[model samples]
Target: MLEIKDLHAYYGKSHVLQGVNFEVGEGEIVSLLGRNGVGRSTTCKAIMGLVAPHGSVRFQGEDLGRLKSHQVARKGIGYVPEDRLIFSGLTTRENLQMGIQKMGAEALWTLDDAYRLFPRLQERADVKAEMLSGGEQQMLTMCRTLMGNPKLIMIDEPTEGLAPQIVTQVGDFLLEIAAKGISILLVEQRLSIAMRVSHRVYVMGHGQIVFEGTPADLEANEAVRKEWLEV
Candidate 1:
């Protein structure tokens, strides 16, 4: 339901995303995979309008070229940043409440669903956000964004800096989200995790998409894996 064509982004004189193009269909999990500095994160920022972008960012056939970040979000796009931007001062429940939006009569997600998905969130519902563990904080951040009931969510490096077990949990969480019919554009560096959860994967290098295909296609292409993905 989201399409980007000839998308270019800049940081002053430095150009980071050069004609990056991709699409995320409804209820599909598409992973944007690449090593650091290839502009995977920058692509998320550009799509969210956090960075200035030139060219087309069309969501549901509407152009988002001139819309501000908040405006882009209002159009049913949720962005979960790499840093896990949670409100340290607010309680977990309060943080979830902050992301609430007016929904159509057919809203698919709710606080109840979040609690059901991650029982830890419900257990710590009243605890201050900063008091939670790193994994818990990450869960809170993703759940909080779900409170908005977005059509598509862009998650940037959701498993970064977390323990292996927690990384597995995050992968399971992503699968659960996808199961509920939400489109996802996941910016993940971990190939195994991306392959496990993504329906299709796009490998990027030098600020451009070098390869795009299904997870099985990626597995069979050792050269592409070595050249663009393997560290």
Candidate 2:
């Protein structure tokens, strides 16, 4: 559903994503794993057109390198940023309403669908987003993106700073979403979370994809794990 080839991005003069390449097939869950500051986030930002990148970014065979961020979003791409940026003042329902786009009659996600995926959100439907706990906030962030009805959703660090039980819930939610035919591009630091949720994984180091394979393949290859992921 999405492909990036020879991707290079920069922040000012510092090169971030250098010759990065990867792909996410339809209904597939692909995790991008890396430690802090390895350009994992930058790659997502570039794909969403939030950062300037000098490389090929194709979504469903359409070139997306020059499109603006919202344009990319309109082209069936949803993004849940690392920082779950819920409106402090808006109610949970209101925050979700902000993601609705007026394009298709067959909406990909509705209130019912979101509630089914995250029942806690339904319980707090009328509450302000800021009053929710960290796990609730993360769930809300993912739901907000899903409301846009994206064919491919890119989630950044969904389990960061959450309790273990909540992390497990989020992992199950992602797996369910993938089961429903939503292609997922997951950027996560938690290896276990990535391993549990993704069908395939890509290990990034020094701004490039050094390893790409099944989660089982990653676990079996101790050398790549130690070389790219060990602290």
**Per-residue lDDT tens digits of candidate 2, residues 165-230?**
999998999988998899999999899999988889999999999999999999999999899898
TM-scores for all candidates? Answer: 0.97, 0.97
- lDDT of model number 2: 0.92
**lDDT, candidate 1, 56-175, per-residue tens:** 999999999899999999999999999998999999999998988855566677788889988999999999999999999999999999888889999999988889999999999899
What value does the lDDT take at residue 134 in candidate 1? Answer: 91
Clashing pairs in 2: none
Candidate 1: deviation at residue 207, Å?
0.5
